[model samples]
Structures are given as structure tokens and as C-alpha cells.
Target: MTNYDSAFRWMKVKNGRLHFASIELDIQKNDFENKIVDDYLVNGFKNDSEGIKPWKKGLIRGLEFTLSKSSNFWTIVIKELQAPVLDSNPAIIGYTAILAFIEKTKIIIDEDDLRKIELFVYESWKGSNADKVPNFNKLIFE
Candidate 1:
């Protein structure tokens, strides 16, 4: 089996949350108790969809938490998307928006991190699931 298949199969799915090592993509519920809640409330919720509403909420809340506490929030978002759970789309949306925000604001990200983000974006767009989500590539350029 491929590395992804092996790693994915080993991940624990509990309480609707995918646990990858120590990081948990808690899909069960949205925890709004975070420092960056204001940004998500003011801006992130505008992109929510009906089908994945809860997942989207959880994603935004997770982003808020990560942004407040993690130095490598971008990496966390990217890795979170690797989970083949129901909230993959939500995670994708969250990370795509984060990448677009970074690019638009000219945030000083490390070269390696930027390259990894670009690679992930390219692979995501080239995947079959690309049609199901917004055109993230266009958003990056916009």
C-alpha cells in the first residue's frame, strides 16, 4: 500500500474526530472559545455551506485556535486536510482561505513553507475533488 493509505488506515476515528498522532481534527463540534474567534465570526462564516455547516464551523474554530497558539499554523492546516474524513472539504476550504489571505496580505512566510503550500494547492486543484469546491487557484490570484 501507498504511504497515504497506510497512514490513513492507522488514524483513529473517534467521536467523529480523526486523530492523527497528537493532533486531533475534531469534527464532532465547533469550539468557539478561541482568541481568533472575532476574525472567523466577522469573515470566515461568510463562506459557509449548508451541507458542511458543522464541519465548516469546526474548521474555522480550529483555525482560530491554531492561529492563536501555534507557530506553524499553516502546516497544521495542510496536514489536517490529509485526513479522508467527512470534514476534508471544510479543512480544504479553511486552508485555501488561509493561503489566499496570506498571499493577499503579503505575509512573510518561509520559502519552504510557501513552496509546500503551493505544491499542496496544485495537487488539490489537479485532484478529482477540485470540482466540488471553490476555485482556490482563482482566489490566490485575486
Candidate 2:
């Protein structure tokens, strides 16, 4: 097995409901996150991880394509957005669409790797004039 031969459960929307799919993928460890964080610190904007995006987008795209053989590549856009979904006490259904699927999956990654993902995502959402991601100071957790 390769270093990143790991399994993660993925979910997609179909017929106004969630469709579950599982697959094993190869996740190569890299300094993508560290670089993003570093760039954010120095330049006030993180702009690395072009290498990791393909790997991540490919996994989500594959799962989405399997659910529906549509010819749209927007799934990658949503996957990369990682937008903030309000965590309410009752939890609104439609509003939590993307997050619900993500919370159900189990992926194997070292702390460093996980940290990288978090950093990259944070930087993406943290808003930078260079990237136009507006620092929305919006807290996601309730």
C-alpha cells in the first residue's frame, strides 16, 4: 500500500437527499498547508497548494460524477469553498448541506497533514485583497 492508501466516506445530493459513497484514495503528504500558513503570515494572504487542490478536487469530483453522470465541474468549486455553515441548536437541513456530508467521513491523516488542510481552508476563507476572499470575521461554530 502507498503512504496515503486511506478510505474516506463521501456523500452527495440526489433526489433532494444525500447519497453516500465510499472509496480509498492516495493522499501524498506535502507541505502545502505549511506553505499556505507561511504565506498568510508574511504576505497577509495564502496562495500556495496548487498541487494539493487537484488531488482533493479529483476525489470529490469522482464521487459527484458517480452519483450523477452530469457534465458539470462545479463540484470542485463547492468542495474548495468550504463555506461556513451556521451550527444552530436545531440544525437547519438545507443550510447544512455541504457540512453534513463532510462530518460523516473518516479520513486518515497525520496531525501535520490535518493541520495543513485546516490552514489552507482558513486562509481561503480568511479573505485577502489579493484573492478577494474578504476577511469575513464570521465564526462558524456555535
Candidate 3:
């Protein structure tokens, strides 16, 4: 099992909403949050678009994610952006989208633990709510 295996098993669900405290703590302890942010900024944004277009798009989408308390990075990417559901789990995609959102918003998360909270949310969703596997054609031709 991976380091987060037990954490995933110990997920808490309250009021039909999953809580990610355990996973968030694990990510912070392992220092994966910085890697997630740096990778998203340097690789994800650059490879996804050219020039400032990606930044502008990220800001817009980020704001949308932030303002919609009912929506999240995974839902926005899947339903709004129509991103192809691929093999990579929701945790990774949600993490990047969250970083972009955090970048565009005044939400004051700690710089060192930036991705921790988002990771928790996404991980919890993946473990407790999301389908066991991704549907590659969920947004086919969209």
C-alpha cells in the first residue's frame, strides 16, 4: 500500500460531505504540496497553452471554481472545460486546477501548504465518492 493508503481508508464523511483532514496532513508531511504547485506552474500551464492565454484561462476558471461553493476543480474540469477523463486520477487534475484557482483568488492559504487542502478534498472525493476508474469517453467529442 502507498503512504496514503491508510489515510484514504480513514476518510471521514459528515453531512454527506467528505472531510480530508488526514490526507491533507499527510501531503503536508511529505512535502508533496510544493511539488504539485511547481509542477502545475512550470509544466502544466506551459504545456497546455502558449503565451498568456493559459494564465488568463486559468484565472477565469479559477474564479469560477472559487465562487461556486457547490462546484469544485474536478466538476469544473469535467462538466465545464470538458476535459477528457483520462487514466490519471481526479486528485492530480483537481490539484492543478486548485493551484490555478488559488493563484487567481485572494484566498489566503499558507504558501508552504498551498495544495494541501485541495489535495485533501480531491483525495477524499476519489476515495469515497468518485468512480473506481475514469471513463475515457465521458467527454468524447465535446
Instruction: Encode model 1's per-residue lDDT on 1-142: one tens digit a residue.
Output: 1233322222334345443221222111224432322222212123334654534443453345235433332332222323244334433554444443344334455666545543443443334543344332233311
- State how far residue 138 of model 1 sits from its true place (Å): 24
lDDT of candidate 2 over 1-142, digit per residue (tens): 1112333333334334333323332222243221111111101223346533332333333233222322222221122222112211111111222232233333222455334433333333222311222111231211
Q: How big is the positional error of residue 9 in model 3, measured in Å on the Cα after superposition?
A: 29
Candidate 1's displacement at residue 71, Å, is 5.5
- In model 2, what is the error at residue 7, expressed in angstroms? 19
| Cα lDDT over the full model 3 | 0.32
- Who wins the lDDT comparison? 1
lDDT of 3 by residue, 87-140 (tens): 222333333444544443335545544444444434424443333321112211
Model 1 pairs whose backbones collide: none
As a whole number from 0 to 100, the lDDT of residue 18 in candidate 1 is 41
TM-score of 3: 0.26
TM-score of structure candidate 1: 0.31
**Which has the higher lDDT value, candidate number 2 or candidate number 3?**
3
Every candidate's lDDT = 0.36, 0.26, 0.32
Location of the lowest summed lDDT over 10 successive residues in candidate 1: 21-30
How would you order the candidates by TM-score, starting with the best?
1, 3, 2
